[model samples]
Target chain A: MTLRRIFSFLFLLNILSCKTDSEILPSISKEDIQIKWPDYFPQPEYNFENNSLTKEGFYLGKKLFYDPILSKDSTISCGSCHQSFVAFAHADHKLSHGINNLQGIRNAPGLYNLIWQKSFFWDGGARHIELQPIAPIINPVEMGETIDHVVYKLRRNNAYKSLFNKAFMSDSITSQLLLKALAQFMGALISTNSKYDRYIQNPKMNPFTDDEKDGLALFENKCSSCHPAPLFTDGFFRNNGLDSTFIDSGRYRITNLPSDWGKFKVPSLRNVEVTYPYMHNGRFETLEQVLEHYNNGVLQSVTLDPLLRNGIALNNTEKRKIITFLKTLTDRDFIQDKRFSE
Target chain B: MQRQHTLIFIILFIFFKMKSILKVSLITLIVIIGFSSCKKDRKIDVNTEDPSIDKPDNQEKFGTVSIVFSSKAGNSDLELDSVKYTNAHGDSLTISKFKYYLSNFKLIKDDGTVYKQEESYHLINRSNGKTYTVELENVPVGTYNSLNYLLGVDSARNTSGAQTGALDPALNMFWSWNQGYIFLLFEGTSPASQSFNQALSFHIGGFTLPYNCIRSISPSFGSQNVLVTEGHNSTIFVNTDVLKMFESPHLIKFSQVSESLGGAIGSSISDNAANMFSIASIQN
Candidate 1:
C-alpha cells in the first residue's frame, strides 16, 4: 500500500509539471503574409527565392527599421531619415541628416516601390536593396554601426532572440538574415493606391480634373520620355543639365567615364508633392524652382540630356498645370497608413 | 470491512502501474525531442554554409583542394615597406599595401572536363599578413591537370546582391563609389612620385565597356595530374611576382603615372595580370 501511494503521487506530479511548463511558455506561431503589389506594376527586381517572404520576418524587420538600436550611438534608425509621413523622404532637409548631426552628400530618397528599382541612392551605387542597408548602417556620417556589432547587439537582446527564432526558426542572428528581414519589410512597402492609380484602375472611379488633365498631357509630351508612366522612372542615368562644372560628378564617379559625367539617375515623380526639396543635391525647394531650372537654368555640358538641351518650353500657366498633375501622385492612403507607422 | 480493504488495494495497484508507465514514456519523449532540436540547430548552420548538405541524392563524390598564394618581388619574398623593389621602368617602389580578389576557379580534369567551384571567391590581403591559403571543399573527386581562375569579381556577381564569405562587403574589398570590386590594389611610396608624400596608389577595377578589367589565368602542372581522391588532401602552391604588374605590355612607372587612374591604369595592370602568376608546386 505504501509503494502504490508513492507511485500515484509521482504520476500526478509528472502530469502537473508538463501542464505548468506548457502554460508558462506558450507556443509562438506566426502566419506568412502575401506581399500585395498592384497588377500594373512591373515584376520586382529582387528575387524572393533566396529569402522567402514570411509574416514573422516582416514584423521583425518593421521592428528593426523603427528601433534605434541599429545606430552606433543608439540615436538614429533607418526610420529617422526616412519617415512614414513624408513618403519616407527626409522631408525638408536639403542634405539628409545623419548621426552626430553630420549631413549626407545626397538627398534622402523615398523608400516605397523599391523592389522595382535596380539600384539604390541618387548615384545608384548600391546594386541590391539587400545591400542598401549596409551603406547607411556603416556610413561613418550616417547610422555609423558595424554589421558585426549590430548582429551582436541583436543576439544579446532577449526579445530579438525569440523573435528571430519565430521568424527564422533559429535563435542565431546573422547579417544575411538581418539584411533579408530588412528587404522583406522594405519590399512590402508597396504604394499603389494614389488617385492616379485608381484612375488607371478605372478612369470613371477617380477621374482627373481639367487642370490635372492638361498637366498630364504636357508631362507626357515633355517629361514622360525620362519619367515614364506606371513606375514613373525609365531607370536610366542622365545628365539633366543641372550644372556644367560638375561639383558632384554623379554617375562618372561610379563609371569613371567622362561621358557619364553629371549623369544622375532619373527619379520617379510618384509622391513628388510630399517629397519636397528635389534633385540629387536637393537644391530645389519647390516645384516652381524645378520647372524654372529646366526652363532656363540648364547649363549646357557634353553629357547633357539631348531632350533638355533646347530647354523644356514652359510658361507660368503650364508650370501650374504640371504642378497640379504632380499633386495627383501623392498617395494619402500610403503616407497615413498604420501598417508602416511606428 | 475486509472486502473494502481488498478493493482499495486493487485500485492502488492499478494506479501505481499506470503511473510508472506514463512516467517512462514522458522521459523517453523528452529525450527524443531534445536530441532532435539539437540536430535541427546544427542542420541550420550547415545549410547556410553548404546548401548541398540537404540534397545528398544524385550527388557526386568530392574532396577538398587547398591553394596557397605566396607573393614575391622578383626572386625574393615580398617584404612590405622595405623600399627594396625596382620596376621595369627603373623606378624604386616600396609596397605598403597589396590586395586582390581571386575568384571563379575552374578545374580541368584529365579528360578535358571542367568543374567550377561553387561560391568560389577569396580576397587576399597582404597587409593582414595571414595565411593567404584558401581551401575549396566538395570539389568532384578526379584527376585534374590544370586550373583556371579569374583575378576579379565577375560582372554577374558585381550586379548581384549582398554576398557572403570573402565577397562580403564587410571585408572592405569593394569600392563604395563604384559598384564593383577592387580587383587589385597596390599602395606604396616612391621617390619619383608626384604626390606630396611620394605615395603611389593604384586601384584596378571596372566592369564597363572599353575598360572591363577582369583577367583570367590558367596554370598547368607539368607531367602530373593532381589526384583529388575522396578523403585525400591536396595542396597547390602558386607564386605571384609583383614585378609583372609594372612590366610587359604596359610599363607603369611611379613617376610617370600614379594614383587612381580610374580605368586608365586599371586597363593596363589587368592585361599584365595574365603573366603575373605561375604554379610552384602541386602535392596530392
Candidate 2:
C-alpha cells in the first residue's frame, strides 16, 4: 500500500512539473513573426543579425512606440508625430510641434521602409536605424526627455518591466535593448503592397489605367533618376533647387562641407498621395505644387543637381497623369494593419 | 519477516541516495575539469609568446595594469566651478564642466609586442571622481615601455549603432542632430565677454575625413617603465594639464572664439588638447 501511494505521488509530481514548464514557455511561436518584403526590393541596409526579431520584441516595440512615457512630461509619443494613417508622416504640420508648444526646425518625415534607408532625417545625420530615435527623443523641442530619464521611467513601470523581460529575457533594462526594441518595430515597417506593386506583379490581373500607365512612363523618363521603382528613393543627398539662399543648410550641417550646402536627402515618393505637405521643410502642400516646382520653379544654385540643371519640361496633362500614378503607390493595407495600431 | 522487509526498504533508500550523490559528484568533477581546460586554452590564446608557456609550471601568466588620470590646471589640481585658473592665453576662467573620451588603448612591451585592450572606451568626466582611474585586467606579465590611446572615439564606433557604458548616447556627450560624439567638452565662465553670459564652451568632435579630431596620443614615461608581475598591479599615473589645451600648437583666446562646436576650429582645439597628457610616475 505504501509503494502504491509513493508511485502515485511521483506521477502527480511529474504532471505538475510538466504543467509548470509549459506555463513558463511562451505560447506564441517565434517562427510566426517575420519581416517580409517584396522579392523585387533591394537588400535592406539593416540586417537583423544583432537584434533577432520575435513576436514579443515587436509587441514590446509597438508598446514603447505608442507610449507617451518616453517624453519628459508624458505628453508626446513617437506616434504623435509619426501617425500610421498617413504612412507615418506628420500630416498638415509644416514643422514638428513638440513639448511646451515648441516648434521644431525641420518637418518630421514619414517612417516606412526604414530598413532600406542608409541614413535618417532630412540632413542624413543619423547613420543607423537603431540610433535614429535618439535624435527626436532628446531634442528639447521634441520629446524634451533625456535617454537616461527615459530608461529610468521604463524601469519603474511594472508593465514595461514585464514586457522587457518577455522580449529580452533579462532582469535589467538597458538603453541598448530599448533602442533595439524600437529598431525592431521601425525596421519591420515594409510598405510594398500598393496597387503599383500589384500591377507590377501581375500586369494582366491588376492592370493600371491609361492615365497611370502614361504617368509611369513619364515618371520613368523624368523622375526615375532620383526616385526609383520598388523603393521610391535612391537614398542619395541632393539639392532639389528649393531656395537660392539656404536658411537651413541641410547636409552641410553634418558634413561641414561648402559643396554640401542646401543638399537634403531625397525622400521616397511612396505613399506621396496622403503624405502631403512634402519636401524637407514641408514647403509644398500639394502634388501639383511639387510638380510645378520641378517643371518651372527649379532654382539654380552652385549645388543644384546636374540632372535638374535644365529642368524636365512636363505639360499640365503629364502632371495630372503623374499625380494619378503617384496615388497608386499608396499602400492602404500597411496603414490599416492591426499589428501596427495603437 | 516484517523486520526483513524494513531492512530491505532501508537498503533501497540508501542505494538511491548514494546513486544520486555519485551522479552529482560526477557532474561537478566534469564541470571543474571543463572550466580548467577552458581557462588554460584562453591563457594560451591570450599570450602565445609568454615565457610561462615554455615553463608550464608557472600558472599565473597575466597581471593587472591601472592608468590613473590626474587632471591639473597649470600648477594646481583642477577644481570645478570654484577655483579660477589662468590659461596660457592670459584669460582667467572658472571651469564648470570638463569631459573627454579616451579609447583604443594599446600597451607596448619592452620586446615590442603589443597588448591591445578590447573595447577600450572610457569617458573621463571631471565631475565624476570614480572615472579617474581605468583598470585593465589580464595584461601579459611584462615590462611595458609605452602606452598609446586615442583621445576620441574611432570613426567606426561613431557610425555604428547604439552603444552602452561610456559611449552611451544618453550621457549627453553625443550630438543628437549631428550624430557624432563630442570628444572633448570644456564649459566655463570668463570675465572676457563676447557671447551671452560671458560663457566659454568648446564642444570638440569630428570623425569625417580632413576634419577628423580622433587624435592618437602616446604619453612618454621618461625613464620609468611599467612592470607587470603575476601578483602585483602596476599603476601608471598620468597628468592631464588643462592649460595645455588652450595653448599648444594653437592659442585659443576667450575674447575672440569662446565657443566652438565641431568643425575646423574643433579639430584645431583637438590638436592642442592632444598635448595635454603626460606620464608622471608608475607604481608596480
Candidate 3:
C-alpha cells in the first residue's frame, strides 16, 4: 500500500478497534453483570436509575475493593475481611478483622446482590447498600478511613485517577462517584443458581433426594418463619431466644428502646454450605451445634420471637435432614464467577 | 507518539462537550428569564397601575418575628436540663454534645404558595441557645403565613448515605452499623441510678418500623404572618418542658439504658423529645 493509503488504513483500524461506547444499558447487557434471583423473589426495593449498569464503574469498585488504599495506613482492605471464597464474609474469625489487625464489633455479612435487602448487617443497621460501605470505611475498628480521605487518596493515585475517570464522567473523586462504583459492584454480586433452585424450578427433571425432601419439609415447618426460603430470610430482626440482657443490643443500637434488645437481622442462607460457623457473633462452630441450639438450646429472653421461644423440636434423623437441606443453598456458580475472583 | 495524539484528541473532545453543555445551560437560563418576564403581565395596558402606588412600600414591606421557647417546669424558660456531657453506663452512651436535625424546611405563604428554604434541613445547634435563628432569603417578597419543618432528617437523605458538613457523622449523630441516623441526641441524666446521681440519656431515633422518629413540628405558638426579604432573620424555638418523654409506662433511667436497646428506646422518648426542640425561640 502507498504511504498515504497506509495512514488512512491505520486511522480506520483505530476507529474499528474502538469498541462501541459503553452506553447506559436499556436492559441487562451481555457485559452487564446479571443479578440472579428466583421468580418467587419480591420486586427489589432498590430501583435502578433507568437500568444504571456500567462496566467502568463496576470494575473500578472491584479494584478499590481489593486495594488496601482505603485503609488508614494502607494496611487492610475490605477484602481483608470479606474474602470471596467465604462468600464475602470474614473467614474463620469470630469478628471481622480490619486495619492494624483490629477486630470489629460485629461479624461482617457476606457481600452480595444487596439491592434486595430491606436492611443490612445482623442488626439491620444499614438501610441502603450505597451507605453500607461507609460504615466499614469509617468504623474505628474497621478500615478506619474517612470517605473524604479515600476520595483524596484516589484523586492522587495515577491508577485511580484513570479508574475514576472511566467510572465517572470526571476524574474528580467525589463521594457520589466512589459510592456509585461500590454500589454497582455490590448490587451486581447476585447468587441464585443453586441445586435447591434447580430442584424447585423443575421438580420432575431435577429431583430432590428423599433425604433432601425430608429436610425441606422440616425446614418449612421449623425454620420458614424467620429463615423463609427463596431469599432464606424474612428481613426482620428477632431476638431468636439468644439472650436476656442486651450484650450486642442488635436492632436496639439504632433505636434507643428496650424491646429490640438482642434482636438481629435474619440472614439469607444462600451459601450456608460454605459460609460455616454461623450466627451474629460466629458463636456456633458447626452446623450441628446450630441445629442443636434451635432444637433445644434456644435461650429465653423477653424479646424472643414466640415462634422460636419453645425452640424448634426435632429428632436426630430430622437434624441430619435439615443439614442436607441447608447444604442445598450453596451456589457453586457464585463462588466460581470470574467477575468476583481476585 | 501516535497513541498520545489519540488520547489528546479524546480529552479535547470531552472538554469541548462539557463546554457545550455549559453554553446550552446559559442559553436556556436567558430564554427562561425572557419568557418569565414576557409571560407575567402579558396583557398590560401600559401597566394600568401597580397596586404598590397606594402603599408605596407595601410590596417591599417586611416584618420580623422573634420566637421564644419556654417550658412549664414551674416557670423557668425551657432550657436543656444540664450542659454536662454523657457518662451513662454504656461507653457508647457518652455524648460530647447534642444537636437536632431539621431539613426540607419550607415557609408557607399566605396565598397557599410555598417558599422553600435553599437548604431545607436547618441544623440548629440548640447548645448555643434555647432559640435557633435563620434569616430568610430571596423569598419573592411575600407575607408568609407559617413555618413548617420535618422534625428529623428526611427519609430520602437517610437512605441516600454518608453526607458531609452538618450531616457529617463526626457530629456523632450517625450510627455507623445501623444505617439510620439518630435525629435527636437527648444526653441528660435519668434518675435511674446512684452512680454520681444523674439522669440517663435517651438518644431517640430510627426511621424504620417499630421506632420511626421522623416527626413534623409547627411551633405550637401558632402562626405569625411575617414578610421576609434579602436581609432579615427569622427566629424559631422549641420547648422540652412537655413532661412527655416520661409519659410512657417505662421510665428511662441512666443505669439501665445501654446501646443494646438502641432504636427501640425511641418509642419511649420520641413523643416528648421530638417536639422538645423549638425553631423560633427569640425575636431577631
Candidate 4:
C-alpha cells in the first residue's frame, strides 16, 4: 500500500476501534437494559433516575434479596417472605412469616411492577422505594438486622465486596448504595405478560373466552373504579367496608385522620390468583370469599367507601364469571422467571 | 530456472519479514497511543484510598469549631431518665428523651457577614451524651460575634427524598407517617402530669403551614466574639434548659397540657425552644 493509503487505513482503524470501545463501556447504558412492559402501561413512578439501573446493580440486589446474610440470625432473607413463585407473595400464609417463625401483622404483598407504586407497604408508610428495605431490615420480626450491621456484614464478605465494587464502583458498602441496589432489583420486576396484558395489547391476538369477557365487563363496571386497568391499581387508600370496626387502623395509622380509618391501599389485582388470602390483614382466602364480601357482606362504617355503600349487586353466576376474569391476571412468566429466583 | 526460483523466493521472504516487523511496530505504537489516550480521559472512579479519620478540608485558613451542649435545670446538671429537677410550674420531672435537630448553622462576623454551613443538620440526643458536643469542621477563620442555628429540620430537608448520615430516616429521628423530622422530642415523667406514672411526652414537630415548628436561634455571646483562626481549636459551651420548654410564651403545665403531637402546642414549643439555649462560654 502507498504511504498515504496506509495513514488513511490506520485512521479508519482507530475510529472503528474507538466506536467498539464506547459500545462496551461499563457505564449504565439504558439502551441495553430491557424493561419489558406492555405499551398500554403508564409511566413508572420510579424512573430509576436518581439511582440509575445497571445490570451489575440488579444482579447484586438479586443476590442480596435471596441471601440470608442480610438477616440478623442469617436465616431469613427478603425472599423468605417475597419469593419468586406465587408472584413474590408468601402463598398459603395469611400473615407474613418472619425470622424464627415470628408472625408479622400484615400479609406480604406481591412484588412486581413496584416502580409504579408511589408509596410502599399496605399502610403506605415508606414514601420512597430506597427507604422501603430499611423498614423490613429493622422490623425485629422480619430480617431483624440493623442497617449498620447489614452493611458491616456485607463489607467483610469477599463476594459482596466484589459485587458492590461492580455495582456501585465501591467496596465500602454504604447503606445508601445497599438500598439502591435492592431498589434496582425490586424495581426491575415488571409483570405485564399475562392473558389480560396480551388482550389489552392486541384485542385479537389473545382473545378472551366468553366467561372471561363477561367477567372483564363486570370487573370494569364494578371493580375498575378502585382496581383500575393497565397497572391494576388506582394507588389510593380506600375503606372497602370489610368490617364495621378495624383492629388494624390501616391507612389511619399513617395519616392519623379520622376519615382514613379502615382505609387500605387498593392493591394491584395482577397475579392475584396465586397471591391468595387477600386484603391488608389477609382476612379472606379465596376470590369467591372476596367477591362474596363485596357482593353482600360489606359492612357499613364511618369511613366506608361511597362506592361500596350499597354493596356490589352481583349474583352467584356473575361472581363466578368475575373469578374467571381475575384468573387471567395471573402472569405465569413472572412467577417462573429464573432471573429473580435463588 | 532453479536459480531464478531461489532468487525470487529470497526476495519474497525478505519482504514478508520486513512487513511483519512493520506490523509489530505499528501495533506497539497503537497500544501506546491507546493507553496514553485512555489515561488522558479522566476516569472518575471511586476513592480507593484509605478512609481518613478527619476529613481533610481543602479550604485555606479554616479551623474547627466545637459546640458543647450541656442540659441544665437550675443549678445542677439534668440527668436523663431520673427525676431530679422541678419545672417553672413546680413540677418534679424526669426527662427520658431530650433529642432535637439543629441545622442551618451560621457564624455571624462583627461586620455582620455570615458564614453558613451547607447541609448542616445534626441530631443532638441527651441519651448519647458523648455526641452532645457537635464538632463543626472547616469554619472560616474570622471573629464571629453570634452563632445562629435552626432548632428543627428545615422544610427543604423534610420534603426532600431519602437522606443519609444524621438525616437518615433509619436513624429514628424521622417521622415515617408525617414525612418530616420529629425535630424536638422531649419525653419524661412529671409529678404534675396526668398520664400513668405521671408521664409527660412531647413529640413536637411539624413543617407544614399553620403548624410550622422550625425555630431560628441566634445565641448571644454578649460582645465577647468567638475568634476562629488557622489551627485554632475552640469550644462554644451552650446551656440548654428543658424547664424553659414549659415556660415563655406558652405556659404548658404538665398536668394541664403534656403531649404536643402536631397542633398549636407543637408550634408554641418551637418558640420555647428558641429561648431554651443561652451561650455560656466561648473558649479559643
Candidate 5:
C-alpha cells in the first residue's frame, strides 16, 4: 500500500477502538425508572428534575450506599449506619457510631424516598436532601472525612470512577457530582407497596383486620396530625411532649429558639415495626413502649403541642389495636427491595 | 566609476521604498494595538489602571462580588461604621453584631431581565466577631442599572425538596431539625454579661414576609457606569459602620446574652449594613 493508504488504514483502526466506549449503553429505558404508588398517597414531593431517575443512576447509588468504599477507613459505609433491613435506620444503638467508633449525637435515620423530605436529620440541621450525607462524611463523630477527600478517594478507585462515569455523564467527580449521584440513589428509593397502601387503594384487594382497623382509628385521632397518612409524616417538627428536661435540646439547637427547645422532626412511621428503638434519641425499645409515652408518659410544657398536651388516653385493648394498625405501615417490599442491596 | 554610480543610485531608490513601507506598517500596527487595548478595557471593567475608554455593553454587566468575612468589625471589608433603624417604639439601638441571612440573590438588568443564582442562600454572620465578607462568583458580565438582593432565604427554596451546594447542612448554616433555615447567625460577647453564655448569638432567619428582614439595594452609579468583567477584576465596595451594628432595637449589651433577643437586635444592625453599599462605591 502507498503511504496515504496506510495512514487511512490507521485512522480507521482508531475509529474502531473508540466505538467500544459506548458498549455499556443502557438497556433499560426511562419507563423502568417509573415508581409505582398507591392511589391514596398524595403527589410525591421529589420531582427528579436535575437528577432524573434512571436504572443506571439507581444501581450506582445503591452500590455507593451499600459499599464501604465511600468512607475514609473503608469499613463504614452508609449502610453501616442506615441498614436496609431495619428500615434503613440503625438499631440497638442510641446514637450512630461511625469510623474509629465515633459516636454521633442523634440516631441515624432511615433511608428512603428522601425526595419528599424538605429537611433532614432529627434536628433538621440539614436543609437540603443532597447535602444530608456530607454531614456524616466530614463529621468528626461520623465518616470523618472531607468531600474533597471523598472525591479524591473515589477518583483514585477505578471501580468508583467507572461507576461514577456510568451514573453521571462526566468523570470529574466534583462534590456536586458526588452529591448528585447520592441524590439519585436516595430519590429513587420509593416505598409504596405497603399492605396499608394496598388496603387504602382497594379495600377488597387487601382488607385490614378488625384489630388493625380499630388501631388505625386511634392512630388517626391521636397520631395522624403529626405522622399524617400515607407518607406518615407532615414533614414538620414539634415538641411532642416527650421530655421537658432535654439534654439534646433537639430542634432548638438548630433554630436557636426557646419554643423549639424540645422540638424534633416528626419521623415517618412507615416501617415502625422493624425500625425499633425509636424516637429522636432511640429511647423506646418497642412499639408498646412508644405508645406508653404518647399515652401516659407525655411531659407537659409551655411549647407542648395542644394535640398531645394532655396525652392520648389508650386502654389495653386500644393499645393492641394501635399496635396492629402500626404494623400495617411496615413495607415488606421496601425492606426486601432488591434494588437497594449491594 | 560608472558601475559604482549605478549601484549607489539603485541602493538609495530601494532604501526610500523600504522607509515608506515601514512607515505605513508602523501606522497600521498602532491602529490595531489601539483597537485591541480598547476591547480589553471594556472587558476589564473595574480596573482603574486600564487607561482605555469604557464602552459598556447595553445589557447589564454581572461579575463576581465577594465580601471578605471577618470577626472583627474593622478586620474585614463588610464592616459598617454607622447606622439608624427605628423600632415600633421609634427608638434607635446600637447593634454589636449584625447577623442575617442573604438568600434568593438576583441581579436585575435595565431591560427587566433578572438572573437569579441557583443556591443564593447565605447566613451572613457579622458583628465584632464577624466582618469577613463572602464572595459571590460566576455573575454574567454586563452594565447593571440596578441591583435587587434578598436579605433572607427565598420562600420557594425554604420549603422544597433536596438542595445541594452552599445550602448543604454540613456547613452548620442549616437548622437541621427545625425544618427551617437559620438565615443569619451573629455571635459575640457583651460587656454586661460576664458568664460564658453571656455572648449573644443572633440567628435571624424568616423567609415569609411581615417578619421578612430582607433589604433591596439600588445604588446610584452617577455619571459613570458600573462595570462588570468576566474575570476576577470587577468589584463592589461596601462601607460598613461598626457602631451601627450595636445596641439596636434591643440593647446589644443587655440582650446579647440570649440567642433570640440578639437575633431580633440584629434586624437594626443588618438594615444599617445594607445601606453601606452603593454601586458607585464599587472600584477596582
Candidate 6:
C-alpha cells in the first residue's frame, strides 16, 4: 500500500509540473504571409526578416492604421488621409488635414509599393520603412501625439493587449514592435495588376486604346527617364522647374547641400489618375495643369533638372494621350481588395 | 518453508530500495535543470553584448567599470530651471532641459591594450539621475589609463531601423522629420533671446559628412590609472561643463543666435560642444 501511494504522489507531481507552462495561441505559419508581387519588378528594398510578416501582425497593423486612437484627440489616423479608394492618397485635399483641422506643409503622399521605396517623404527625410510612420504621428500639426503615450495607451487597452500577444507572443508592447507591425502592413501594399501590367504581360488579352498606345510611346520618350515602368519611379530627387526659389527647401533640408535646394523626390505615377493635386506642395490640381507646367510653364531655377531645362515640348493632343495612359496605370483590383479595408 | 519466506522478504526489500533511489535521482535532475534554465535567462538579459570582442576566458576574472558624468555650468554645479548662470557671452540663462547621447566606448590600458565595449549606447540626460552613469560589466582585468567615447550616436545607427532601450525613438531625443538623432539638446530661457517668451533652444544633430556632429572624446586621467582587478568595481567621474558649449571655439551670444534647430548653426554649436568634458577623479 505504501509503494502504491508513493507512485500515485509522483504521478500527481508530474501532472502539476506540466500544467505550469500555459499554452500560447498557435501562431499563423510563415508560408501563409508571403508578399506577392510581379516577377518583373525589382527586388524590394525592405525584406520582412527582422519582423516576420505573420497574418496576425499584418491584421494588427491594419487595425492600428485605421484606428483614430493614434492621435492626441482620437481624431486622426493614417487612413484619415490615405484613403484606399484613391490608392491611399488624400483625395481632393491640397495639404494634409491634421488634428483641430490644421493644415500640414506637404501633401500626404499615397502609401503603395512602399517596400520598393528606399526613402520616404518629398524631401526623402525618413530613410527606413519601419521608421517612416513616426514622422506624422508626432508632428504637432498632424496626429499631435507622442510615441510614448501611444504605446502606453495600447498597453492599457485589453483588446490591443490580446492582439499584440497574438501577433508577437509577448506581453510587452514596445515602440519597436509597434513600428514593425506598421511596416508589415505598409510593405505588403503591392500595387501590381493594373491595366498597364496586364497589357504588358499579354497585349492581346488587355489591349490599350489608340490614344493610350500613343501616350505610352510619348511617356517612354519624355517621362520614362524619371518615371520608369514596373515601379513608375526611378527614385531620384529632381527640381522639376516648379519654383525659382524654394519655400520648403525640399531635399536640402536633409542633406544640407545647396545644390539639393528646390529638389523633391520623383513621385511614382502608378495611380496618377486618383492621386491628383500633384507636386510636392500640391501646386497643380489637375493632370492638365501638371503637363502644362512641364510643357511651357517650366520656371528657371539654379537647381533645375537638366532634363527639364528647356522643358518637354508637347502639343495638346500628346498631353491628352499621356493623361489617358496615366489612367490605365491605376490598379482597380488593389483599390477594391477586401484584405486592406478596415 | 522458512527459507522460502526469507527469500521473498529479500526481493521486496530490494524493490522498495530501488524505487526510492529512482525518485531521488529524478528530483535531483529536475533541480539541476531548473537552476540552469534560470541562469540561461539571465545570460540572455545581461550578456547581449557581442561575444567575440570582450568575451573573457574566465568570467570570474572580469570586473565592472562605471563612468559617472557630473554636469556643471562654469564654476558652479548645474541646477536646472532655478539658478541663473551667466555664460562666457554674458548671457544669463536658466536651463530647462539638457541631454545628449554617448556611444562606442573604448577603454585603453597603460600597455596600449584596448577593451571595446559592445552595444555601448548611452543617453545622458541632466534631468534624469538614472541616466547620469553607465556601468560597463564583464570588463577584462586591467590597469586603464584613459578612455575614449563618442559624444553622439554613429551614422550606422542613424540610418538603421527602429531601435530599443537607450536608443528608443520614444525618448524624444530623435528627430522624426530629419531621420536622425538630436545629439545634444539644450533648451532654456534667457533675457537676451529674440524668440517668443525669451526661449533659447539649441538642438544639435547631423551625422552626414562635412557637417557631422559625432564628436570623439578621449579624456586624460592626469597621472591616475584605473585598476580593474577581479571582482572590484572601478568608478570614473567626468565633469561636463555646459558653459563651455557657449564659448570655446565660438562664443555663442544668445542675442545673435537664440535658436538652432539643425544645419549650419547646429553644427557650429556641436563644434563648441566637443570641448565640454574633462576627467575629474577616479575611484578604484
In order, how many clashes per candidate? 0, 0, 38, 0, 48, 0
Residue-level lDDT of model 1, residues A50-127, one tens digit each, is: 667777788898999999899999999999989899999988988877789998898988888898998888888888
lDDT of each: 0.81, 0.86, 0.67, 0.81, 0.64, 0.86
lDDT of 2 by residue, A214-233 (tens): 99999998999999987888
TM-score of 6: 0.86
- Window of ten residues with lowest summed lDDT in model 2 chain B: B1-10
Q: Tell me the interface RMSD of every candidate, in Å.
A: 6.9, 8.8, 14.1, 4.1, 13.0, 5.5
* Per-residue lDDT over A229-322 for candidate 5, one digit per residue giving the tens place of the 0 to 100 score: 8789988888888777888788776555787788888889998888877888888888899888888998988778888878888888888888
Report lDDT (Cα) of residue B130, candidate 2: 24
List the lowest-lDDT window of 10 residues for candidate 6 chain A: A18-27
Candidate scoring better on DockQ of 2 and 4:
2
Tens digit of lDDT per residue, candidate 4, span B42-90? 2323223535624555655788898998887755677887667777777
Q: Estimate, for each residue in B173-202, the C-alpha lDDT of model 6 and write its tens digit.
A: 989998988999999999999999999999
Tell me how candidate 4 scores on lDDT: 0.81
Worst 10 residues of 5 chain A by lDDT: A14-23
Q: lDDT (0-100) at residue B15 of candidate 5?
A: 40
lDDT of 2 by residue, B211-238 (tens): 8999999999888899999967999989
lDDT of 5 by residue, B27-73 (tens): 35434543444444444543455543443344645467554333323
Candidate 3 residue lDDT tens string, B138-253: 45556666676776788778887546556765455777776756776655443444445453455656676666778776654354455665457555554544334443345444
- The residue ranges of model 1 lying beyond 4 angstroms of the native Cα positions read A1-34, A152-158, B1-64, B127-131, B136-143, B222-224, B227-231
**Which stretches in model 4 have alpha-carbon errors above 4 Å?**
A1-26, A29-33, B1-37, B43-71, B74-83, B106-116, B127-149, B155-162, B174-181, B187-239, B248-250, B255-271, B278-284
Q: TM-score of model 3's chain A, to 2 decimals?
A: 0.90
Chain A TM-score across all models, in listed order: 0.89, 0.92, 0.90, 0.95, 0.89, 0.91
DockQ values per model: 0.25, 0.29, 0.19, 0.20, 0.11, 0.36
Instruction: Sort by TM-score, best first.
Output: 2, 6, 1, 4, 3, 5
Tens digits of per-residue lDDT for model 3, A140-191: 8888988778878888889888888766657477766777777878788888
Could you give the candidate ranking by DockQ, starting with the highest? 6, 2, 1, 4, 3, 5
Give residue A147's error in model 3 in angstroms: 2.9
